[model samples]
Target: MIDAQTLEAPTENPTIRTSRRWSPGACVWCGGTESVEEYRNEPRCATCRHHESVIEEARRFMGMYGLRPIGGTLQSDDDEEYEHRLGARDSRRVLNEIRLEHQPDPELVRKALRPRAAAVVAEGKPAAKRPSTASSATGSSRTASASAKTAAPVKTGTVDIDEIQTRALALLDQLTAIDAQLSLVADQSGLAARARRSDLEKQKATVLRTLAALEKARLSAASK
Candidate 1:
């Protein structure tokens, strides 16, 4: 019964028909709905956001280690994930280096990381002291003399061979891990990637050298 001139096609309500909706407390990174925070305009859970911050900070800190990043945006989720893993790995290495350099007490580091746990551990524990060079040398000589006197010649040789084999196997495993890391970094194009590749190459070379040395020792031991 409507007039043809007055009749118009029904149009969709844009607000009601739109596909995207504002989701509060939803994490884009981990698909979690708890402790969500907005990071770079994207919703992320607290843990995910903390890790993201760590990765970003690590990337910025690489320059201190003489490694520079080639400025580029991540093209895909895979690229972002790769960088995240790399950053975490590098961050662990950096932390280890710092710990080694500073020689901080393990308990202190633990307390610093988890302040709430500090109350549980007992305080005033004496730090262990390292032996002096002279004492260490004397102890080593005494131990070697005792072992030489008490251990059977065949047993000693067998033990030495076993130890050499174990060391060689460990070096091989390390080399394999380094190769895998290198392969991962191969496809990535950036100064940071290049630096990581270089570091891995150096580690591989060192491992190869140690492996060669172990082989030489094994051969010498076999000849004996």
Candidate 2:
């Protein structure tokens, strides 16, 4: 016969467990096993703590804007309601993209917040007074008057047809003389002589075109 103390102590496997034990493993999100005590309850890494907090903040922001998603499929006949639902959907999509793509850094998030904060503050500031229409019109009128004063006055006068005709005839005479000189220099063998002839030919062509234009204008003015 065994004694009671010997019988109780002789069992190799105990039927009842006295303490809790957790298996060590990598975090599901960040694949990290460090800081086991910090993430003992949740299966997330320590670095992801800030990231989770940022997601919560984004949710709160959407809530503040009345843009939080509601349960069930959205069915809206009213345009305003539809717009609100659409805005909420877009905001959620953007937030989800940020949560997935970015690792949360405090400085970067703070910098991002600055512009929106500034915009809100600016909205609260008093608006500057706008100039009245009468004053604006007066300013424009003064500008117009100043411009009129500074501008060169246009000469409004009739063309002297006889003078233009006489000038055209003189140009024709000079052009004929130049053409004759050009023909003489064409046979000469130097580069300078060739260039001089080319210049004279250009002058003759210009004179012919100008004389034609002047004669046309003279006839038109006479008819009028």
Candidate 3:
């Protein structure tokens, strides 16, 4: 069954998924029209749908590698997002196809599961070879020279190591200043404790005087 649909966000109720009945035909890309492309009860042949899916996967791969598509992807037939999208759609599927003949390394096998082309790009290498750091290093020298030429010349300001050491020593001296403050606080705390005790003694004497006056008044009343 060949039916068009508007794909909703990844997990939203599709606006037009149920637009077609299940049927079979020769897949245009790879002939096997019996399989479903998007999901169960979804329209579109597997091959054609996989084609579109590859594009989305390529975008994901670019995102993973921190390669932001500037403005937008370049439009061309030979563009990576167009050609290898299907092959990179699921490297796992490719591995599974030939996995019986070869058991790959766990890491390599894991890489195989990723979007193939994207992983290659993310690793900072082409599918054909590793990154040639020699060229980059050579360019670095040129870039450095160019940058130096473009930048303002350094003012011959001399740095005095002794001055830096003096500042560091001053910082240590500031930290030690807390020791004197702490000693002062300790002395004040002791004085405050003594003052509190003196106040308590004065209160005790006043209490005793009140008790003696109360007893004298009682004796006077008895006499009356």
Best by TM-score: 1
Model 3 whole-model lDDT (C-alpha atoms): 0.35
lDDT to native, each model? 0.45, 0.43, 0.35
Clashing residue pairs, backbone N/CA/C < 3 A, model 1: none
- How close is every model to the real structure, measured as TM-score? 0.31, 0.31, 0.19
After superposition, candidate 2 runs with Cα above 4 Å error: 1-157
Q: Alpha carbon lDDT of residue 113, candidate 2?
A: 43
Please rank every candidate by TM-score, starting with the best: 1, 2, 3
**Per-residue alpha-carbon lDDT of candidate 1 for residues 40-147, written as tens digits (9 for 90 to 100):** 434445655555466545443232121233123332223444474476555433322211111223233233334433332345322221123223223222343332
* Residue-level lDDT for 80 in candidate 1: 43
Off by over 4 Å in 3: 1-33, 37-41, 70-224
Angstrom error at residue 9, model 3: 28
Pairs in clash, predicted candidate 3: none
Worst ten in a row by lDDT for model 1: 148-157
TM-score: model 1 vs. ground truth: 0.31
Backbone collisions counted per model: 0, 0, 0
Writing each residue's lDDT as its tens digit, candidate 2 over 105-224 gives 324333544565466557774332122322322332234333221122111112336656777789878988987898889889888997998888878887786677667656655665
Cα lDDT tens digits, model 3, 85-169, are 4444353242222111211122432233346435445768532222222232222223434322112211111122333344445
Model 1 segments more than 4 A misplaced: 1-159
